[model samples]
Target: MDPICTLAVVGAGTAGCVLAARLSEDPNTKVLLIEAGDRMSYFTKIPLTPTVAQQGPYDWSVRTTPQKYSSFGLWNQSQIIPRGKGLGGSGQINFMMHGVGLPKDYERWESLGFKGWSFKDLRPYFVKAFGTASAECDPEMCSADGRCPYSSIRFENKKAASIYILKNHRELDNIFVNKEIVLAAGSVKTPQILMLSGVGPEKLLKKLKIKVIARNEQVGKNLHDHMNTPVYVSIERPISITLSKIFKFNTLWDYVWNRKGLLSFPPMAGVEYFGNSALMLFAMGSASERLMRDLSNYKHEVFRKTFPFHHSSSKEGFIFLATCTQPRSRGTVSLSDISTNTPPLVNPNYLQNGRDVKCIVKALKRIIKIVSSKPFRDIGAKIHWPRPERCQSFWNGSRTSKKIPKPAKTLNKDLVKRTTVAENDKKDRVKMNTGNNFVSDDYLECVVREVAVTGHHAGGTCAGGTVVDHKLRLKSVTGVRIMDASVMPSPTSLYPNSVLVSMAEKAAEIIKHDPAIHHDTLQKTTDRRGGGRKCVKHVRQNGLQADQVYIAQAQVSENKTKDANRCGINSAFYRKKFAEVNTIKTTQQCH
Candidate 1:
């Protein structure tokens, strides 16, 4: 006999996992988790799996429609967008660097008039949920099962699935949504599923012969990603994570038994210089570090990719990942075919904007300077030239399958004389993001359009300002919610896996607390408080918090000093503190 579940959650990735784990805590409420891929296993436990996880059985080898302006490095064709196919989803194949979105990003949602969706409002949820994949339970803090056990092996008996055969797969489970349904599939597939399930723009759904469930004009629109310019540099001392360390017999043995070693190190371990939150002051001509402390949004960053140590000839390397924060380009995921067998058409429209190219080029130049600095030189790290040559498949002629070979000469200077834009105005063009002889605005643009890669932080499809409400419910559909990265209104300032997990944690709480949801059976989330959430309260943002709007409002005041005093309190303190420190240094120098 098949027992009906109180909730049905789609996709068993990060968000899906959290939804299933948290929702099933109540003995009276049954949860069904539907996943397309098999259970998590087979090298998924390893931390440094990004380099090897692709092209394997677990990766959905999805490609974008060839770009006219971006992805120039991929043989002038569509970029290969990798999506994980297993239960863990991208968390299995990702670089494993966890960073949250900036406070301003969440404030943008509040600015758009969506309440209960700010960084302040969400921070408590983040702190309360998702800690150490293993259990971290305090008997006084939680009930016996309040700690969510992350191991798939441990939860084998908990959920049900459809479209895949398992011990609990039901033949008649063609439709879900008895009590409520949540789409935790990522930005890519969530839109695809909604469209295929007949809940998208009416005109498109009609063409695909899908029965219209909801008319949503914004289902798959406003899609964007963190476009990055990656510069690979060789380690001077040659001590970095290598492929041999990841796959060697001892490493395998260590993980199989003890689950500890270099194999356990996250991708953030590769960062040798600055962090992921790099401002473009150096690239944008800020004369002093103190001068640019208040400025942000140019998230050009540096980090390292694991090296293939088996090839001893190759030096251990680090990757400087330059990012264009708040990219202007937007795209859509539409139906190329209605069949589930055919993957959805994902067009990120990478680097379509001229500004995105300039920002990335400037950021790349900053990385070059970082490598040339005394600190990098002291460490023996050098920018590996023509790095695209190392990967033949991703080389210059990738579309044509003819790899671009390395050039023998090296131009190691700090700056090049190329212009920022190919604008009609020659003066503006000359003032572009400068690079060394090896990289010019022209050269970097070509590199950018061709070689720039994604931060894999794709979002904004089911945006809070458009498609979904602040509660993450579909605008046109009832009894449905989205609790994945796909529902993010915009791409965060950081790598977004942590944010996605935080979102799941929050969404679970929101669902459990809503009076209208499961009114008869499910009690308030406070009915039981074994976890850390009992200590935190969801605070609401009552006033305006949009940065641009605040700035604009302050600018309207006739008295400049009064406006500055009112709005720029933090900046004023920083500048004053900087001056005092500089004064002390000057006095010491004179002595």
Candidate 2:
């Protein structure tokens, strides 16, 4: 006989794991979590191994169709969009940076008619999702040194989140849902899965010859991602992380024996946000020519001379990653073929909006200023110009010559001294001159068009108010709820994982409160324990309707008492409503 569960959650990603763990807290509720991929690879446990893990079976890295306005320097003018495969999903193969997003981000969702999703309502879930891990450290202390002391800057679960959830729950891997299904398959794959399951835009489903269970015009539309471009700087000293340091025997020994060392941390050390732009610092350790080419798909000849095996004598470098937090450009995810084996076509229409280009350019200038700042300069860091041949004309020198003059110190100094205005400020403005300035705005814009790639924070596909209702219920269909990044009404200013986890926590509570799932379960449990008749009689005697009395029949068990409390009724209130239901003597009698 097949095992049956009250709820089934698809895609064991960040939200899926959280939903499974939180929903399964009820002893009466059975939750079956499903993941298309296998368990996460062991290497995923190490913080610095996402790059290596991404190359393995744990990743679902895909290439975008030649971007219309960006990725000109990459091979075929396309960008690589990496998604994680396996239990943890993308969270397993991502840079472990924690970000909660700004309060206004959610307020905007509320403004869009997504009621009960404002920052104030979601704040409790955010604290619950982060848990005690946040309580152990002081944000001010971590910020002082430009490095957080925590071994990993991610949510509490460092391993595949399902592993943590299942280890404590002892649940089944596969089962049928008797009540409802929750889809947490992430933004990219969730839409794909929905389309494949005959629920998506009617036109696309018809073209693919799929049986249409539901026609939603908004399933795969409104796809947006954070776009990032790296500004590389060579470090003159060997103090930064390097391949030599990573391969040292002591490094491995310390990680294996004591679980602390260079390998204990992520390669991308820290991140800071300013206005709508964010700067992520990567310890670009001893970048080889091949590695550089792989990281940023610059022209081969340009990459060869521009960033050699080791740019400086120390063979160490760092990357200032400038990210446009709020991108206006939208893209789409569509099924290329009917078969689930075929990956969906992704068109990240990056930098198509003039605003996105301008945002990234400003961030790039900010990176240049940071590299020239006292802190970076103290480490002997020097900027490396990645002037591909196509963009050579934008620079200061002759377009034909390989020799280029140093960037203008005046421009860097000016940018450093300038106080940035808020995004909403009408006075926010900057004047530009593309003429013979050492590194002009034209050059920065050209670089952005050539090199920017997805920050891997894709979302807003199965958006709220469009595809799903405020409660995350799929509008076009019944018995289905979408609880993941896909339900985000807009792109967040930071990593979406933190927001996704919090959403799941809140979603679980919302699902629990559903009268259908809870009422039926509670009614059956009361009957099985022979307390339903007594409860109904007590309610009738007290001039209360039988349906209004939602009682939990239990005895001397802490878990049962907690479960009863979760029903939204207190012991005193229940006693006042029904004094002698099922012959219970006191409030403690139920426990």
Candidate 3:
């Protein structure tokens, strides 16, 4: 028989690996980690080849439902949301830019009634996850500092969580967790996993003919992501990254043998924060027509006219990628069927909110301001704005009379309904005194509606306060927890990779000390082959007839706290009683 573990973690992504490593520190407690994707391979190991890795077998390459407001430039108006499928998961395929996010980001979560999730509460976890290493010491590495000084990412140790588990804890391989099952399958898929396991919206489960273990209305509700629009700038110098420079024999040799040089470097050169959002600056590198076509999906005519020198092998330009980090718009993940094989319908609903569009436009103006400075002027940098026909009239030097386009009609129908005609007219009244070099706000808004794409930082589907409690446990279910990005109340102001790692570290600590997990009710022998079905069958066959007794005891305990306020009584007390009584009843039933 396979050995029973104290905990079972699903999805061997960054968070799952972290849990497996941290929890397995107890020599007596075993851990079982299950992954749906293929194991790690050499293809995903390189630092600079994230796009290449994304194209490989390990990436889910899931496409979102056609956006009603945005992604007009993308193929079929459906943005591709790439998710890493293998052991290391997205950590292996991401740009390697680690961001812990601003303090306000977590403060917002605390404001939402997530008591222990403030930045102050989560700081230690960040320190614990990143170790003593300094990413800033390495020229190639990039990471956020100031508040999270210890947080760092290394090119060589990119797969730190996965590597730690595979190398350090080989003995805990043959095991299955009897106590608890934790889902860390990322934001996009974790909810699907929960729904498939019969813990989801009751109506949906009934419709699909699946058993309802628990009715969680918020399982797949709060889906949101940072959307970015890349603004390319043409430069006189060949200082930017190019295909010719990247494919050089020496460059490959240096990365493969010495583990240094351009090939080992991260794609994003730098990041600049603007309030809660950010502008990620990186070289366009391979400006070839084919590569540009694949990356942006803008019309061929627009690309040809805007980036005329893109056909050349030289460093054509750099991209000022502006992202709206804290978008108000929310979307969802839902199932059309019961099978886990079927992809969950992901609708990010990018730029659905007017605020998100305005935020991106503000960042674009900032990019223009920066490029106008002496430093950029010295490099002869010029913005290559994509002239989609709709936005062409509002261009800086358009031959036609420049009039501020009616944004209300151009935007989403819902957004249009919310904004009165007076409000739109008021916004249009802002002086079109934008210099001959600058375009009007109307043009930028249209550009945002056309060109924005997913920043690949999707989260908040499961969400803390709704699907799971502050402790990361599923509120409706017992012995199950979610410790991935799905538990985040909102998508952070920056890259969520570092924040997710910190969350995993904190979750490990919570699981280690939580008294509820140690109860006798969870110690029953689990069926290895049948998965959750056997456990559910075991519970049904044994039954929780002692629930009435526990309820009586809970009532008695609650009465002791004047007027028997439900909040006054510790929920843990009821859990302990339920566990003890159920254990006894199960034993009696067996006899």
Candidate 4:
């Protein structure tokens, strides 16, 4: 007999592992956890080299369908959306920047019919899952004893400057939070799981031959992401170098001798910033106290060391100005085929919204201004990709290209020349259609069209309430549920891992007491109750068998006399008499 398990959790990434571990706490419940990839313990736990987590056994490198809005056209290059297949999910590969979403973000969910999912309500779960070691503590916002690990990177230099930048920018000081799954599997895998589990558009599922459990047309729709265009500056000296080279020969010896140096830091140490005014306000004030506390508790010891000050670069250093905010552009995730193992079709319509262009442009300007401050006058920073001098030209070209009008064409000259001009004019009707028009606008339109990219934050496939009902249950199905970031009604400006964790935590709680928990067992018991009805059928069959046996015995007795007379004298006459007698006897018995 197959072993029976009370709960079967798939995908041992952040949410999966956490759910399994937490649910298994009850000794009575047996949990069967399945992961498509290998374990990610070593890769996830170590703080030194998180970037390595993107490759090897832990990563699930998924590709997207070619985007229509992009300049590459139908045959454009595909986008690669990576999610960790191993344990801890994308959290193992993430930059480890802990931040909580704005409170208004959650309130928006409440408005959308996702009851009990408001930021205010979900705060405790986030606090319960993580422990913080950062010096700052907002008890209401954070917790000290949580199962999930939380810490900040320590810096070696310019602590004051780092603090100044964070303090001056209220937006950067916003706290991040997490609770259950950590949902760090990134954008690609989250929606892929939802589509595979039969919770997406009906047309896409039918095309893939997947039976539709729920007909949510909006499952993979409305995917939006933040795209970062790197502006590099050629530094005269390398300000930040890895410990791998500095301690090459004696690296192992140093680590063994003392647990110190560059080996302790995470990859790509950086601070979060919001250039968009609306986002800045939302991050600072719109969020709840609990979320703020959870984020404030994260101690970035590594970030503090790497980005210590506004002028914390080498004698000549580069600054990575990222546009952390995004526009509300949407896309989709649909099934490629019916096979569960096959990946889904992902289409993240990045930069489809015009506002996103404006946001990115604003972010670029902010980065230029910050680096060109009076304190950095002597450092002499230069914008590498789009030089400061070309800002005007770039902006102008972008604007002009967006507004170019369609060209107008008159009827062919051949028709006009063949007939009298007046007669031709009277016969022919002018057609006004903007079907084929080449943009002759400024340079920015062409450039904007050429440089668009994705931020890799696709979401809202199994969106809460809108697609799936509030209990995380599929709106049309009884036994299914969606626990990934696809359940998010909308993508948050901050990272989604923490939010996903909290959502999973809530899901796990609900599952523990769900009616479906005993549904199978109850069904089996009911089947046994109906088993008695089969006995009546067996009795009827037995009666029919007995009647057939009696008829066969009577026929044998009747034939015995005819057989004996056949061997004696007058065999033909005897046989004929016997047949006649039998027929007469049969007719008399029937009467």
Candidate 5:
């Protein structure tokens, strides 16, 4: 028989590993971590086999709705949204080009009403996760005070982790929760689980004939991913680690014997090419004060402002890559079927916003400059950009043999009615019969619409002030809280695995200490500060059964004012803002 536990954390990925390990430290709370797949394997240990690892049983193999503005991918499929199925999640299959966001981004969150999410609040978690950056990266490659202080990607799977893995729950069954269920299943599936459990937008739920437990309209809105556009480059000599090298036996011996080969390094690891989003856009498209002013209004702006570039690291010459580090376009994650057995309809809606299109256009221009730079010139590197009329040939390959990106599929009639923006854009868009340049706006926009893909970082589904509160609790629900990329008001500054680990660290801290014995210790902090206390009564949710006796009181001191602020306790600002629930709930009216 399975032993019951205090906390049931779903998804034994990066976030679940951290949460389960940290939460289990308190012997009083038994953690039941559930995953749809098996534990860590040998392939995850090998940093070089990212592509191979993603193809096997460990991958979720999700694809978006055929993209309207971007190529779906080869073999008549939408672009793949790669999600890891086993332990370690995407961390197991990710390229391991680890990174974090700018500190100022958190500060911006504070200004935007996320009080406890400032850099000062989240810095300790970042330090706990990845340690710190040691020194500034190369000046030419970096645009800021770049510091990659430390490297801690050595895999250690056997550190008091999980012992059991339950792939799925039975149909029409109830999960008995002692305290709460923590949803850290990640951005893609967390919302799916919630909607399946009947907590999501009422319309979406109603459409699928699923019973609605809560009316959280923003359950899967605000989905964002880094927009990536790759330009293949040709170098005169063998400088980068490429596919040609992988075909050779000598390269294998170099990796196995000396650990000094292409396999050991992630794509464009130490070397960098960073450019500011605002500056590059201005440099490329000339000045538009409206566009520059519009930059600050975006949460994507709070992300890494500079676009980071890398190489395909191929022998014939590597591919020069450009990514819109922060994209303004937003998408949604919706239910395809009522069953959890089906994957959610994930639509990152890549390049829905005109601003994101403009951003990537600038990014493509930047890639051209990098190839043109003297350093690249010395290495005989030139951009091998493949457009509709272009293809790579060792000895003047024929255009007919080239892989042409097939035209995007026709818009779904239902999707067409809902997506007025696309129809309008399509109507106004003039077909370019002629006009192709290595660095032209129209040329690049065509490439982006045809070949641009996601950086595989989808986040900001259950964002703050939307589906969940600042504490990541599902609005109008109790005994549940979210802990994943979906809760992030926006995507992280860089690759989000480390940041997800840190967030789990912080979330585990919250779960363990909430209404626990530590209140006595926290009480003293208030005493030391000579702060007054208030017993703040907040309904876990208002619309409950008339006989429902769900009452939770939060005893907050001035030291913990942020908690009170979030719950609408003594803060007059919040009280006035939420005047509907100012005094107290009348049981008769509430029910």
Candidate 6:
């Protein structure tokens, strides 16, 4: 008899590992945790450098199919989609920026029929999983004494500059939250795990030759990611501290000896503003002014208290931020084949919707305008990678492609004519067409194409209700459950890590209350003969009859083909090839 484990968790990624650790707390439950890779404690918990955590026993280095829309028509040149294969999963490789979704975002989940998943309902779990942030916590936003540590690092040059830019843009003020196994394993591996364990499209499983344990068509569909346009600014002073330069002897020794210096901060740090309903209601217009005052008061308090390093830096550095809240576009993840060892295909269909393009352009223009404002003008910031001319060229190229004639010159003239006509119209036709009122169509499309990158927020594969029920149990299969980012009903606008943790925590509670161990079924096993013991006699007879059929066909075909081959000199080679082909055909027929 095969050994019976109380529970078999297939992945040791963020969600899987968290489930393992939490479920094992019961002690009576013997959890069989199987990781496709290695342990999390294998590497020391060091920040900034992810290279140490990305290879050998830890990573599943999956590459995406060339993106259908990205990088100004250049295909497959976007950054490689790397996901962790081992314990702790992407939490070990991620740039440790702890964040949570807006409260309204979770309320939206409740509206979608996910019971016990609203922000208010899930708040305690988020608090239970994270340690208190050093920054001031809004009683409504942050939690204390959670499983995962949440604190701001001592700001180095890059982090400090980024914070300074974000402070002026008071629109971004959401807190980070997490609980249980904060599923930080990222986009690529989340769906890969779901499909590997038989929780995806039924037709895909048959094509790959995997057993159909569950038939959830939405398992690997509706993938979404946030794309960022890096605000590359050339600082007058040489920037000594960066993730790449942190390994130098001085920096390494300081970290090794005192656990301080540039190595303490995460690889990158920046704030984000949402363009969704949450941001518009609280952080825009006259209401935004009141929030800004509250934020300014909070910053003053933060500076006075424990964090003295929150002050702005004089040296110039780059700023990177998200362009929009909840991109309208979506993509998918699917199995490459039946092989469990092979990585599944990851395809984040970026810029599929025209609104996503407009949102990105509006966000970019807002950042540029903010940086050029009085608060940052004294700092002497300048656009580095995409100079104004490059931005213009990209806009021209996008417009040229959209015109009736595919050529560049014709498109430019057409766009100019269209712009003049739209400006003259009283009803504002241009605003309706471009989605965003501020930016031109050509400019918006260019930003979307050029700045496209993964936000690493992928979900809805093992989606609740539509795929699996709210309990996460497979609708058609017994003794199998899904507990990863794929289980999200929809992608939240916030960082997915905290929400995933809440899911694992809630799933653990659900499992404890019902105990999946006492289910009323046992898995059937196949014997050495490749059939159940009850079918052994019938299977043997079928095999014998199949063998007889193959022999009879071979005897008749071989004699007839050999006799016909005697007509020509090249017939020997033709006969040999024909025989080889016939043999394969006969073997297939035998089954």
Q: Which regions of candidate 5 fall more than 4 Å away from where they truly are?
A: 1-3, 72-77, 111-113, 132-175, 247-250, 270-314, 389-438, 516-591
- The TM-score ranking, best first, is 3, 2, 1, 5, 6, 4
User: Model 4: runs farther than 4 Å from truth?
Assistant: 1-3, 41-48, 69-75, 132-199, 234-238, 242-247, 250-257, 275-316, 378-380, 386-453, 513-591
lDDT string, candidate 6, 190-237, tens digits: 455546545568888788666555577877787766665443443344
List, in order, the clash count of every candidate structure.
9, 1, 2, 25, 9, 5
Q: Candidate order by lDDT, highest to lowest?
A: 3, 2, 1, 5, 6, 4
Per-residue lDDT, model 5, residue 111, is 60
Model 3's TM-score against the true structure: 0.75
Residue range with the least summed lDDT across 10 consecutive positions in model 4: 544-553
Q: How high is each candidate's TM-score?
A: 0.67, 0.75, 0.75, 0.60, 0.66, 0.62
How far residue 261's Cα lies from its native spot in candidate 3, in Å, is 1.5
Candidate 4: tens digits of C-alpha lDDT, residues 1-591: 112244544444546544554454444444433334443445344344454555455566566676555423112435555566644556556545445578877887787677888887788877754542212112222111101111111112211000000111111111111111122233455455445545567778778665555577776675665554334433333344433243475655564466455444443455446644221111010112222112212123312222233232223344353554646667776656544345667777766776665565555445444555664455454434331222234332232333423222244667656767445433421221111212122222333334334444556765777766888765654434556666777767756766666666667677766654523331111113332011112111101011100000001122322222110001111111111110001100000
Sum up the clashes in candidate 6.
5
lDDT tens readout by residue for model 2, 288-383: 665656755666875654555544334778777788888989989888886444667888788889898888777777775676668878878777
lDDT of 6 at 428: 28
Which residue pairs show collisions in model 2?
556-591
TM-score of 1: 0.67
RMSD of 2: 14.6
> Which ranges in model 6 have alpha carbons more than 4 Å from their true place?
40-44, 51-57, 72-79, 132-199, 208-211, 237-240, 243-248, 277-316, 385-441, 515-591
What lDDT would each prediction earn against the true structure? 0.52, 0.62, 0.63, 0.43, 0.51, 0.45
Error of 2 at 223 (Å): 0.7
The 10-residue segment with the lowest total lDDT in model 1: 582-591
Residue 509 of candidate 4: its Cα lDDT? Answer: 79
Clashing pairs in 6: 129-146, 129-147, 130-146, 219-461, 462-486
Judged by lDDT against the true structure, how good is candidate 4? 0.43
